[model samples]
Target: MTAEHGPGASDIDESRIPSWIACEDLLVKMREELIDRAIKLLNREIESGHIAVNGSTLFSSEANADVEEAMYLINNLIDDSGRLHKEYSEYIEKNNGKKLSDAEAKKFGELQKFVLSVEQLNMLMEYARVLSSWADAAGKMIEGKDTEDILRKTIDKEELRKTVLEFFINDSECRVLLSSKEIEAIKSVLGA
Candidate 1:
């Protein structure tokens, strides 16, 4: 086999594989961008009555819980990938950038392949589905003409207040995590 055939079929060039630090940075930036896009699209969809799930329609609260779980899982996967990159970095550093043995190349090649796969997976779609469900549930829980009390009960008022403040402070372009109407009610409650 030759390098042209594919990875792992021939000598894996240490220089060809991305540095772990670079991969980690890419993963972190990708994670943040994808999450932000997902949140914004999900909020829009929840407001529009279209949500993504694994083909099953769940009640609002149930959907919310499931979405939250999905978000947690997605985050964990990204975190794990980041750690894998760091480990690869440490391995490379420990060898003083020497050429890796066949065994080490195989191992690190697999790690790089996995990390790249994760990066290409279009996580935004999955996240949007999951977060849309969450926002749907949260929106329902907070939906009402007079939701001052409901808002207080649903989430920490101070936290929400802080979130809003931080959002403005950071000048973030991502949409809020709730439907527009829900956000209005929350703002009214928090006086944002």
Candidate 2:
């Protein structure tokens, strides 16, 4: 007896499925959020006098080296993340209007995970940069009284602090993570 062939026997042709633009959009949003968070963290460190004041060092020489190593890792992550993003964009452009299989969607989801990892890495790097800057400033402040004068003249620390905080809180990307009420609270604290 011969079995009858049906629709199940024929492979479904889905070469017309449009790629999800939302994935790329979300990745972009995530990157913006990461950058904003970094800036906010940096501002917080500065405002707390962690970076601007002369005091006992937080990280010793060995610890400082370790911290730098961590920063290097984060920088690498950012570079790799950027490359992945470029690849994703290229794939989307090349396959525009083309239907992706379920397997492809799953792969895209995995790629998104990598994107998030990079976002986290960026935040870490930003934190490291803030700490490094603070350490340098503090060292200068310790060097001599003239160093303090130089720092004061070079950047109106107070003014710049306020401005940076304002920019972070008012940023369009930041507005989503922070509510209007929260933003107001931050502004009040920053004296913006």
Candidate 3:
């Protein structure tokens, strides 16, 4: 099963979920809950006969290979999306105050959708990485191991906050999805 195949998966009704531009805290909490569900499923599987335990905790090689493939595909998509975004921006800049033709506007809209998808994927990947590291650190700490260095290096609050703020500022489509209060809170955090 994929990482997303656990109980209460992303197959939930779209209308019930918050908008994409909901406050960062809400979005993060949603993701964290999903991760927690996945962890619980993994634990159950290990405890049951679904996954074999060989004394050392590790995922199956097939799972690792799937993750490797996903990373490769995501990295390629990010590179391609970056190049397309730059090219499209230049194309629009060359308009020199002229309005885009219907076809041009349609293409621009499609590009925006593609870029947004890539961005959302990137953000989810970031959340997964950070949360996974935090889970690992927590486990180590519980075992009486020193996880101070890991925690210090993995949790950079200011940098992450700035990144989220910048994302909201840069993506108007996503910004419009936020409520006024959410926007105001983000502004306050940025001291804007």
Candidate that scores best on lDDT? 3
Worst 10 residues of 2 by lDDT: 5-14
Better candidate by lDDT, 2 or 3: 3
Off by over 4 Å in 1: 1-79, 88-143, 147-149, 156-172, 175-184, 189-191
Q: Model 2: number of clashes?
A: 2
Deviation in Å, model 3, residue 176 alpha carbon: 22
lDDT scores in order: 0.43, 0.44, 0.47
Stretch of 10 with least lDDT, candidate 1: 3-12
Ranking by TM-score: 3, 2, 1
Number of the candidate with higher TM-score, 1 or 3: 3
Model 3, runs deviating above 4 Å: 1-71, 93-97, 143-192
lDDT of 1 by residue, 69-100 (tens): 55554555555656755776676457655688
Clash number for each model: 0, 2, 0
Q: What is candidate 3's lDDT per residue for 66-143, written digit by digit as tens?
A: 444445555555566677658766865675466889987776665555545555555655655554444443333332
Over 55-83, each residue of candidate 2 has an lDDT whose tens digit, in order, gives 33334467565444444444555667677
Prediction 1 TM-score vs. true? 0.27
What are the models' TM-scores?
0.27, 0.36, 0.40
Estimate the overall C-alpha local distance difference test score of candidate 1.
Answer: 0.43
How do the candidates rank by lDDT, highest first?
A: 3, 2, 1
